[model samples]
Target: MSHVHVPALASFLLAAGAAFGQAPIVGDIEGKEFRPFPIAVTELRLAPGAEAHKSAAQQLVKIVRADLELTGAFKVLDPKSFIDTDGLTQSTVRFPDWLNVGAAGLAKAQLKDEGSKLVVELHGFEVASAKEGLTKTVSGSKDDVRGLGHALADEIYRYFTGEPGVFRTRIAFVRKVQGEKHVFVTGIDGQGGGQVTKGGGLNLLPSFAPDGKSLVFTSYRLDNPDLYELALGDGSLKRVSSRPGLNTGGRISPDGGKIALTLSQDGNSEIYLLDRGGGLLKRLTSSWGIDTSPAWSPDGANIAFVSSRAGNPQLYVMGSSGGEPKRLTFQGTYNQTPAYSPRGTHLAFTARDERNVFDIFVLDLRTQKVARVTQDQGNNEEPSFAPNGRMLVFSTTRSGARQLVVSNLDGTKQTVITTGGEHSSPSWGPFVK
Candidate 1:
């Protein structure tokens, strides 16, 4: 396969505001080498002298603190280690008082009732300037306090990290147990691994829609790995496409109104972008090559993917609206599954070297240079950047079996997130709120 050269006219970039504020921004990446942030959080106060539900308020504080910690971007100051401020609220925080505890950021929230709904108000502030960073309210049924707390966490995440928070997003991945494989969607930290497919031959490769209400993934529910769309939340199901020979790759657009996937129904594996309602938007690749792993840009103007159009699999950039493609990577001989960062200046993918060891790599879209994030001797692939573009979650073989791993995008501070089971095809969810 040879590199496809696309024309420059089709290479238009989206506005920064769109990328900076966009939700569900998807791209490929693993560990970032950047520095981590440290912060503290405290329980919101019940009304003055109102002590009917102090425990519930305390639960909300713990949930908020844990949600931020799960992002891998923030290091929450341990509540046990800090002096207690159990009854603090959004209205009563003295900026200097909290700062003296050595926290760079602070989180304070309150629980209230607006008619029949339970409303949780959260505040994120910078310690130095005492300036409020972000504030938002979440409303839910009285029993849904946990949901409300997670929503507040999303607001706090957006406050410090300009991108949408995955606090409310759902992660879909393949889980294998007792020689059986199933696809699942759970909280960002693998908490909600709800099985989407069962009794599998191999249910791998799960991708959620931009709305996080649905998921499109490859499943062996039919005894052969085929593409299926499973509506989430209520778990309604639909079969998106099941081509004759292959149905293993599918990705939804950022707008939640389209899909780009690889299909062999046309007699060869090729990339196709389809509308939300199942209309063909465009055929991206028409070749005999194995053209899979299609990831749409935030603006939906182009796609970053891995194609074996060249003799060896490599990362390539092509017009999302249908035009010639351009090679985005040239350093590696085996680069598969190229995902464009939401910021459009970076790409994350899996690359193999002469020794046949695969590692996660991020490419600087502007300088056209490559940086390896996983230096361990084992195999690391399938890197998906967080919505903030600062960290990525990927699968690593370092844990003796394939398991989930997270780290800063710069390749430092690596943390193996999953303990048991064969977990692969890890897709970090979008801002949950």
Candidate 2:
């Protein structure tokens, strides 16, 4: 039937006006979208005679506020008219000052210079309950203050959302520019992006180690798209597997103990598991047709993957220990890239309907009921669960290019999180810290 479901990622989108406006701070979707919980951020002051670092403190506050705003789950309140606590501390916060501004959550801090080291005190307060709160202290050199601000924002995120903050996490994706695709890594908010691969070869489908210290991707540097591991912090690339045929789509298990990927050295593409040391543990599936895109269950007891053994690619769940897989998708003509949620209960994948349109869908393992994640769109594929299981990162062809997009699980507040050219195959890393 020639069931080819891997379509180029393109999707519909809504306009974001406030995200483009300039204020003390700006959140991407404020009105008529997934508005983040209202929060206030104030710049803390330094000690007397520290006037030289006053500008530094102002920059640090904006840096922190901008981060939490990107989550698309927060509504960051501008501090322009809010009371300015030059030297704000937890005890010094005037709760009404933020409450009057309609801020449900507030952040106040102080930046101090302890000799050559700089220290920051950050706090998250809930005005309604006046009980949900957190205090964090980060110390580093002047250059590291920016990094610490991101860390502080992450802390506030966790305290309020119960979701592990992704403020400090990094995202690695492949981008196509001028007809050439290159791999790049950037911080969670799509900032500080840099090239990780330098070659005329076409590189794609780069997956990261759970720790994000390294990456495994398919690169055709020598005319062969083999899987290679590239270490970050340094621009070193190691070819992990270049089996005579195709080596692509590397996915590391959650435990960081094994990697499951597609291979065709045997003349047919199938799924195989490689141990942490790069030793082949076992072939996961061997069908006369194609079986690819293997995602490991959170417990490592089973694997959720896409197989065409049923005449069309469909979602299948097989024992991690190796056994015949049970197909999970029956209504769709094709389905692939089965991603397991971090909570270990649901599976999300790209399902293609008869109209040849693809959208994100979530299936609850307990009930086997499928729920569409993205509504009427151009095309939405490769849905990945955020750490909190409340959101996802996928590839969409909106804003005039194929780029990475992030949205809640229910597709309530969808947002395109990238500004780069044609990007796809976004793999969100686990909590790094």
Candidate 3:
């Protein structure tokens, strides 16, 4: 909020007192009352005598603040409330200054553009303990300085939350341009958005491999619905399944050993398992009704899918090896696009509420309770979880266009990830391995 200038300092001093405190960031958060941790992010300083990448420095801190706020667990204090802007050295930082502003945690960094890379020395502090929790130097190409900032945010997040952060992961979605749809990939924050497919046909349902190196989707390039895998490294396309009739709804397993998809070649749509190379491994569902949109659990022991067996499309979970299916949704007549969280506690999907409005909902697997993620917003659907399962990506029509939206798991906070395009069928990719 304020543009107070801070001199460059070598070391940061953290002060701890009992005046301000925050809830511990550990333990199970499911079904708990939401409480945001108060944190303050200081403007990053430029290293001594280093060429000032002013824009990069500002963007880096901005992104770090955004990444934390987007989690819905952090409340970033306004910069105007900061009382200490002087050079923060190990002995100069005053705990009372930050605690006065109601900040339980503080994050600071120094940026240096060293020709080939942008180097950053980042630090995290606890106000109550008056101690630094994280101090690390991270570097990245000048072209990807935002990534460096995200990496820093991840470290701070892990330091407090003891869990992995999703800032470095990516999301895949369908971006429509002039009636042509192509798969597009973007960072979790919507940076680096680029078309992954350039063919002259429709491409949809872009699902990433567990390794995050390739995307598998259904395409109409050959004038028939078929499955194809696109190598993200070299932009190479390989046809995975071109069987006669219908081939769609392809989802790769967590172990990368199999793919679960829908095949209507037998005059009836059913869920089927295929080897990584498209060979039919087994039939997962032989229901009389349409069964599609299969998603694998993190352990690869179960598959959550959509089925119309109960005379209405609903969510169902069955063993990956194929067995009696158990319905997982009863509150909605229409529930599809089930995405099991990697944390193994929730299943996010699109459900039509009683008002016939499509919204995103997350089912607590442990509690067997359904929580709505989107409400009163124009048709929000196709929920996909970030790698850490703390966030989700979906398409919303609330802004008058089918745009991509990123939100915390409960949907209390949301941010649009795309603008000026009709994007849908979003799938968050795994962390880069």
Candidate 4:
């Protein structure tokens, strides 16, 4: 599918600080406690000739609200509490009415049908000062209401937080179907996507290339745990590594030039580096104990992996070009699947606590401080960070069925993104272009 293009309709400066007369609405995401910024998203007003698009507009509003709420930074006020629902312009909006309902920000949009396309005029206002802070016009195919909604949500998030939203990003995971594990890709909300692997025996450990155009995973369709890269655009598959023994846990480097994976061809499971193709570049680890699940740092300077060289499977970090490994986790006896944040400031991995239950934890690289992300929530593992580094997607068993869950950094807000089938090994894709 072609990428959707969303352009601003006019040049409007955001006077958020001056309008609110307060600090930024969103504070440190890593902090232990936070008060969600209350924002009101009004129903999309139907233009004169767009009366037929009521359902589409409603769906778009729902998508936008869901995206904003999933960030754990914004609380979308209920529409029932809105007093001025017909206001789509600054002159019509009553700032005091919104402020009375505990809304600091307001979002209003108008939907229009342009024959060949659908155009939406989005307006954002600061409810405290009756000032407009954002104005955008998003257009797409009539069938792409979801994309239109996500684009608008992203604009609203950036206007306030100064960071790109992950609404348009994709996620990949392994889902069991007909007793075989297949790889699937979907939007962050786990909607409007389909299975990616076919004729699959068992596909596992799916990771995305930095470009967001391809996915690398371990597939046993050919009777061996070989590494394969599947192009997401054209459905083309290429075998990246097929050693005599295990070739699994393939993670493409952030630069998209190399792959770090586990190989057992040397009679021991060790981390190895390979070129974009199937050619071997270097053997990164020579430990007698198992070393696997290599994850690259955002800048491609280092890698984090699970190693048993310290007697128990624990997290370790090393230079990408072969260097002495440094242990990162001391409290957990079993740690695996290390995933570095996009900012290179933290590492999220799965650790088994004293009760032998697996959960997610984050380690601050700067302070050497460890924080738990999930606790007593059934077994959660294989955490993959979103491109923004503020959220994570992992497999969880808390829903009675193994499913995929997206969680904020502190585990306070977690929403299951997949259901019905046993899912695991979720890898959140990079931000879409």
Candidate 5:
């Protein structure tokens, strides 16, 4: 994939003699009541002599608008309601017209086609005070318009939320095709990626390494559920663990030096640690109950996994170096697939309720509070948090085909991002540099 080059076009400062200060944070992501910020993204303006790139410009605008809406933090206004189509310059933007359409912020961009690259000049404005808050220029290969769009979306997200965006990141999931299940990777928006595994293997539970260059998953290609690593750049495969029995749920540590996975070599399923090359490091759990699905915290200080030591499946947390495990969930009879947030403040997991329906829930480590993320829609499972920790990607049967869904922390904004197959076990990858 070609890299998107972003260079500063103008100083990232508010207009001189502006009437208002920096835009206040839209809403607290962790709060109960979240009011989406109203914003308008104007149609892309083609520079003089750049009319040939009109189709690309329209696609770029669609990508940015869709990305902003997917975050559930901004309500992108309809272009039909826009009263100002004069130009993209500061003097031509009518702040009163934007406010009249309930837009507190406005975004505009102009596209230019260079000899071998496409250039975009992006601008963000605060409608209330008519102050320009952001100005950037991004460029990429002529064939990589999507990359440029995602890069611009990331910049806009950072400008408003003071946090990095996951638009440029990727996600790995298992999709069944032609009677075989394989691992596939795609952009978080579920576009512009291809299958990562082949040879008719039943690959599952794919997780990304910290550097986002490769993935670790369990494949039954050899008649045993063994852990294998696939390089994203070259499609090369290497066996990481092939014990006598199950060796699944391979999750890399935050530092990218070790892996935590479930092993059943000792006659029972237990959590074990291994080096990147599949060498044994330590056995973290030894209980008779089945222990699996290990997840590492952001700081690599603790590991969370599911265990049945208490007679039922429950989530537990233990030191990465091996220690007594502490249970974290008590309300649900069955809870598994624990995924820690990027900030290590919460844990998202799958829980089965009294009605035998599985749903996703988040547990706040600080307040010991559990929040329901999905309900009554379908059987949702295997939630993976985005790099920003503000959203989640998981598989849901709400549409009767078991497609992947990306949802905000509150479940207020859920979007089906995949189709045409039964997708499951989503693992949201880290940001790509």
Candidate 6:
């Protein structure tokens, strides 16, 4: 399979923000030889007479530590190993103490209560340079204390990585409870999860709208495997596609102007392009074998999908406007569920090995190189890239029950976030503003 080169979409790079700034902490991420940087986060302190900040103070440190630990680029030290837990103030941080603890970076925070809200002051510093890297303040209602932690984590991440973190993003996944499958939404840390589909009979394959306020998924509520759009604002559900049979794998384009999905209304499983309102625009593939799991490139110029036209299920790349298809995978006998990274440099999917176990693999579009992301971990599948393109979320059965797992791009720092339920088909949502 050769790489397919297409003209660049002018507005692609500007979607996330201005051109992405170089990572403040540089390493060879593609080469997978970079060592994780040792970072230490001090326990959050509470202002005097602010007993209301007790719980939130503890939560702030927990969330920030978890977020940085998941990146794989940083090694968060245990708080018990800190010598100056309460003395590392913004103006008085002792970098020598952190360096003695084998940490190259240090983070400190303080929490205060204001009437009905909580305010947080966060700071980051380089242990080697002994210079402050970040100073910011975040505030939110005490009821939403977790949100403040996420905001502080994002600031710390940007201070050290230059790129924004997806701590504020959400994830949509399918969880089967008591033999019924329903769509559920959760924060990136797996906290604050609740069902989005209440009247659902069987809901699966959830794809978040680019705006992060809606989702497109396959449902059998009307006694058919039809597609439905779920509005998060009002819990409203509208049928997007109720064609004769097999309406599944619906993915909204990055620009939100089009949708590329698998439709079988024509008696053959194939990929089709649809307007945002579900009106058929054009059939992208007409194949005898199943062609499904269409993912849009960041530029919206190409789509990577799975098909069996090569005698076995493999990945294929084609133009979004309908054109000749080029195969993309040659190493795996079975490859499906292709997801294009937000950076447009790689495609992540699930591949089955000779031992009949499934794991995630990433394909470098530029070099046509395939790198295995998970192995010997109980059947990991359905990888979804975080908005930052530095992390991914997938479902794994390593704990004897399906759970959502988050990992870095190089397959390091894998952590299972969800503890209960049979969760699968996780899709990382876009950055929330």
lDDT against true structure, model 3: 0.81
What is each predicted model's overall lDDT from 0 to 1? 0.70, 0.73, 0.81, 0.85, 0.86, 0.83
Q: List, residue by residue over 1-433, the lDDT tens digit for candidate 6.
A: 2222222211222232344665465333323346777888887878776776687788888888888887776888977888974454546776777888998888887777778878877778888888886778888888887888888888888877767878989999999978899999999888986999987489999999999999999999889899889999998888888998889999998899888888889899999998988999999998779999999998999999999998999999999987999999888598999999888888989988888788888887877777777887899999999998888899999889999999876675798989877999999999988
> What TM-score, to 2 decimals, does candidate 1 have?
0.80
> Mind giving the per-residue lDDT tens digits that candidate 3 earns over 1-433?
1111111100000000011132234323323444678899998888875546888988888998999988876888899888756554555678888888999888888887777988888888888878886788899998887788889888777766656678888889998977889999888778886998986889988899999999999999989999999999999999999988778989888889999999998888988999999999998888889999999999999999999999999999999989999999888688899998775667888888778889887776766766677788899999988876667899999989899999876666899988897999998888755
Residue-by-residue lDDT tens digits, candidate 2, 77-170: 8677687652344565677766778988877776777888778777767776554357778776777666777777777766665545676677
**CA lDDT for candidate 6:** 0.83
Backbone clashes under 3 angstroms, per model: 17, 5, 7, 0, 0, 0
In angstroms, how far off is 397's CA in candidate 4? 0.6
Model 6 TM-score, 2 decimals: 0.93
TM-score of each: 0.80, 0.85, 0.91, 0.93, 0.93, 0.93
* Model 3 regions more than 4 Å off: 1-32, 86-89
lDDT of 1 by residue, 1-433 (tens): 1222222101211233245664311121123223347688876756543365577688778778777766556778876656544334445567666666777788776767565666666767777776675677767776766776777777776667555556666667787877878776676655545777755477778887877777788777776657777777777767776657776678888888788888787878888887765566777787667888998887878888777887878788888876788988777678887777766777888888767888887777776766677775489988887765666788889968888877665555577767777889988777654
Cα lDDT of model 5 by residue, 255-319, tens digit: 99999999999999999999999999999998979999999999999999999999999999999
> Over 4 Å off in model 6, which ranges?
1-19, 26-32, 85-91
Q: Which ten residues in a row have the lowest lDDT in candidate 2?
A: 6-15
For lDDT, candidate 3 versus 6, the one ahead is: 6
Give the CA lDDT, 0 to 100, for residue 265 in model 6.
90
Q: After superposition, how far is residue 304 of candidate 3 from its true place, in Å?
A: 1.0
Candidate 5 residue 245 Cα shift, in angstroms, is 0.3
Quote model 3's TM-score: 0.91
In candidate 4 the C-alpha lDDT for residue 380 amounts to 94
Tens digits of lDDT, candidate 4, 383-433: 999886768999999978899999877777899988798999999988889
